[model samples]
Target: MHYTFSQYYIYVIFVAVMAAFSYLNKLNRTEVFSFFMYAIMLLFAVLRIDTGADYSTYIEMHEEAGKSYFTDLFSFTEPLYFLLLKVLYFFSDDYWLMFAVVAIIIYTILFLAVKKLSIDPALSLLLYIIVAYYFISINQLRQSISLVIFLYSISSIIDKKPGKYYLLNIIGFGFHYSAVMAFLIYPIVNTSFSKKTLTIIFILSIVLSPVIEKLFVTYLGELDTLYTKYFDIEEYMEKNYLALGKVIVPNLILIYSLIKFKSFTRYEYSIFMIYFCSIVYYNIFFGKHIFIRPGMYFEIVTILYIPIFIKKFFDLVTGFIIETLIILYYAFSVTLYGILINGGQGVVPYKLIFSR
Candidate 1:
């Protein structure tokens, strides 16, 4: 059975509660409630079944992990990725345990990352929901773990610990090869971009998206036979604009926030650059189908940035007008992603194995 609207509303209420707690906890200077909210999110993640685009695929992977020995596993995957799976599988082959392990790692990294980076943690979690980072985590298994490592390693990069930053991302790469992209944040964090440059780049990306899309597919397809099949430029071109429009308002708003809030700390700049690259590839490029998947790496930073963005942007003046826009903005984006986009395809109609 599909997750009904009632099930969808449950997630909406959950986001609202976490948002409220984040705001309150920030004011109160205690993270007790925020921690509880983190637990709730984790529980939801671990308990759910038959969710995510890769839910069944991961189950098959887990069974493989259960059967494969050390050497055989290494032939296909990074050592650590299979190692962890093997270690876990030694205990049981249940997919729930595998999901539990990944859920813990993701929520833990996100919880810690927000605590370190955001002025308001609850708001960050709220933005996480609205911006669909949490959904991405639920969908992308290996990359989710990779992203956790990337998020955790941001501080090391910001603090000028290049050795540690690179090392962490190297570890992340073991989970997903795409994680090597995290290495770029080190340089992007240090470089400066004027607002004019950012604006020009954004416009150029929009104009050249179709060209960029074709170029990327051709280049990557030359390197990998898989790319030709997975990154089909023609198939994506038709549907790309529709997906782009769904989140355009929020993307533009985020860009505005990044621009307005710029005096660029090493961390903020890193977040902005990641978000910028993703926008160029995912939104501006015509074949967002494939790009948006990877583009989410940068986009996830919006979760960390949004709380600070809202606090600073809206603090000077607060009113029904401001509050309504902000609230509606997030609620609409959540619907656009979770329902209108795909009937909450990946995460809605939450299910448990026992329930089934």
Candidate 2:
């Protein structure tokens, strides 16, 4: 008995309403609201919708590798996601149930991590919704799980423990090699910045814009071919470019806010500047493929910074309203992408569960 689009829409609205109510009741116990949000996200995961070819690829790997090798191969860098999936596979063949459990765990971790970092619950919740519903909800198995690992990695980095950060990055890479890029950032992120250094980096970022495409084509063409064979990189790149303008616009706003507020810690400033430069460079030459799609991962960081900037620049009430509006905007935008543009049908791809 497949659920219809109307049924899924009702389910989503119910969850969203519940989340909103919990968010509105600030005087209520924090744990209670947090738990309710987690529960709603779990339900959404249980009734997940996936489309496009990524699902087919995951299922193919599952069938070809069996349970053991499936974990071993996929765990390459994302040990937590691979292990979690393996445990679920051992218990049952119900992919939807497994996805729900994973989603709950991911959201819970992100919530706790943000709280530990001294962020507001409302802002943290907003970040979770943006990532879960907008960027990840439509592709629960690979990208969503990979995002969980990425969040953990970021938490470790925030704690100022390089060892743990590296280990988490390794785990993230196991699930998705793209996460390896986070490690390459340690040198840049850890270094003390001077005005001269910032100028050099900004210059390099600008200069690299046009040449990046040619460099990728000439030097990294084989790598591109390999990615295409394994991950359908071309198709994703094409679709990603469609909304390039929208993605770039928000990032530009974020950069402007960061510069105008000027209250960032050195580390925070480094992250903001580096990512901002990357976004600009990506926008100029490669269109949206460079920053917009991958940039979604940084939304969590961006939300955290936005609130800090708001607090520094405006009164608490005004800051709160601004953050709330940002959250609502991101939430609606993500919802539209997942529900309307992505043709989300609330059907988990059962073939990816186990060998039939």
Candidate 3:
């Protein structure tokens, strides 16, 4: 189960080239590179390298359903994604087409969201690339599509249109039920955070960890039973629990920074901190299923704030060399952890599409 040296070599070379181009383009901030980056990431997604078994499950269901029946109508938790994928499956069996459609949808929604936020296009593009490359690789059909819908819905929230926001979530939930939880967090979207509030939330997050798990396992077990054929409790817990540390550590730092700096808007801080706390608490007790499952959706919101904070941090720090080093560190570390170690978990392995 070891990757051949050629595999490693090719990955290293591809990343090195992309990094170099990224660094060079940061100077001019060209639109060409941004588009190029989008295309590359989309192509990678289509290749379907390192895709999870859920995709195969999706294809099988579609093939079995034929034209007379809706294949995923009952078995699927997310009706929106099921329907979307079913439509795409009609055109071709190539999973890449599905990936490409999702990538385009996500990119379009993100572009609109960031532009409305008044964030710089180049920075937004960079963050989108990072997300597309690092996060959307594994669950190409389910998670990625859900993420796009979720982000579009979040952007609607930013516009102060609650009706549109909830509508999108409803649509998204048809694709994945986990998306429904996102709607639950809407009321607190723009809530203010004080030192006292922050402390309380953090303390509550820690304290509620175990209690939440007990309740979920006991009460929500019915939900699991309904989808038992698709989900295994033991396996879900194992994968999520193992990955908890990876999500919590960085998130904690982000939370601490947000509080200390007090830079984010009240709504921005509230959503990020609340979601961050939720993820940590859920992961600590209930395991990764509660964390990683929702964590992908959370990332879309959190990522929007990251570059803004990074730019603010750079402005406050006032050292060009240090900023350069910080960016480089993130690029290399994120790329390695995201791609190399995780088998490019979120990255589409274009080379493996036909191989699989």
Candidate 4:
């Protein structure tokens, strides 16, 4: 889709409104306000038309799935996702219905996750929008569904129940294969890593990145799939190359969390490790885009972490100064960085399903 500078500001204004609702009362917004906030987000996602990067592509896929037999799509697309498309298509041929259904499922799980895990639900929901996960859902529907499913699995992870966690992630994998990466979280979070060790590992991942790329190209890139084709297509690969927001900003957050390492509760530490893995993957697989998809399973959890981190860090050390700094950063990042810098992932010039 085409994006313009004016539309970017419009998208920023939309997000600014969402932020106003989120920060209106961090401790207590009435249930009616909560309902309104969620309804706005849900409607924004559900009603969009030709607004996301993959809008037309997913529309084509939806039409194709409706016309094809299950066996035809099963070879490439995940079974459950194909099934979901088939079910939605069966109800109506309208592709908008598919987007609406997926939006409902994703936001529902996200809302539940924020309620269960977030120390500040409003802040977590705000991060969901400002951090671009909400927009990411508008674009990459299948993987976004899988990502939120992984979010739901955090409770299972924290409860230390391997069976339940695996079950949830297995369901996630059925939506997107990249969810296989989530299988490692149980062990990663369960194990304790010293701050020194995490730092060493982060440094090593960056230093060894070239070698990692060579290994991926020589071995993994040989696979004959759209994902693996990135290595061979110079232009495609260049466009998909890791961005500053994906790498540096996240690593900075990881560093910020590690700064208060000694005071971490088990739950907070688990959250930190999950986010840490996201940056590690970003660094280790720096060049190619396909390998980076797995990191999102971990990166998305940072929405939950941000609010808690801000609160804990505020209580322990920096006070409102750092809190103000973080809020300002989020405000700028959501408006300027997201729309102007990242192009809002092609979600500008927002249009509803009713629009031409």
| Strongest candidate by TM-score | 4
Q: How do the residues 1-356 of candidate 4 rate in per-residue lDDT, one tens digit apiece?
A: 23566666666776778777765755465555455667888988877788876889989888878887877766755778888888899999988888889989999888888778877777777777766677778788889889989998898878888899999899898888989988888999999888899889988888898787677778877553455445433443344322544555677767776676665787788787888887887778765667657778878887887776777766735654555555566556543565444564666667777775
lDDT of 4 at 310: 74
For 1-356, candidate 3 gives per-residue lDDT tens digits of 22444554545565555555555666776566555655665555555554553566656655543342475466756556667667877887665666667757766655555555524454554544443333443455555556667766766666678888888777767767677667766676656566676666666767776677677677775665564422343564343322433454445556656466656665466446545655554445444243456656665554456545556555645534443554454444554444444454533233566686
- Give the true-structure RMSD of model 1: 3.8
Q: What shift in Å separates residue 47 of candidate 4 from its native position after superposition?
A: 1.7
Worst 10 contiguous positions by lDDT, candidate 2: 345-354
How well does candidate 2 match the true structure in TM-score terms? 0.70
RMSD to truth, every model: 3.8, 5.8, 5.1, 3.7
Model 1 lDDT on a 0 to 1 scale: 0.68
- Residue pairs with colliding backbones in model 2 are 76-174, 77-171, 77-173, 77-174, 77-175, 78-174, 78-175
Q: Each prediction's TM-score against the native?
A: 0.83, 0.70, 0.73, 0.85
Arranged by TM-score with the best first, the candidates are: 4, 1, 3, 2
Query: Residue by residue across 93-180, what tens digits does model 1's lDDT show?
Result: 8778888898998899889988887666766676665656676778787787888788778778678899999998899888988776
The per-prediction tally of clashing pairs is 2, 7, 12, 0
- Model 2 segments beyond 4 Å from truth? 1-29, 49-85, 131-140, 194-242, 261-300, 332-334, 337-339, 342-356
The per-model lDDT (C-alpha) reads 0.68, 0.53, 0.55, 0.75
lDDT of 3 at 264: 64
Q: What TM-score number comes out for model 3? A: 0.73
lDDT of 2 by residue, 1-356 (tens): 23445534643564367557546645664666655665665655455434333555554544333367553754345555566667677777655555567556666666665555534556555555553343344454555555555555665554578898788667666666566556755565566655556555555665775577566666766765554432133454444332432354355555555456455675466446545544554544453233333554544455455545556666868876766676566555544344334443233232222332
Lowest lDDT block of 10, candidate 3:
237-246
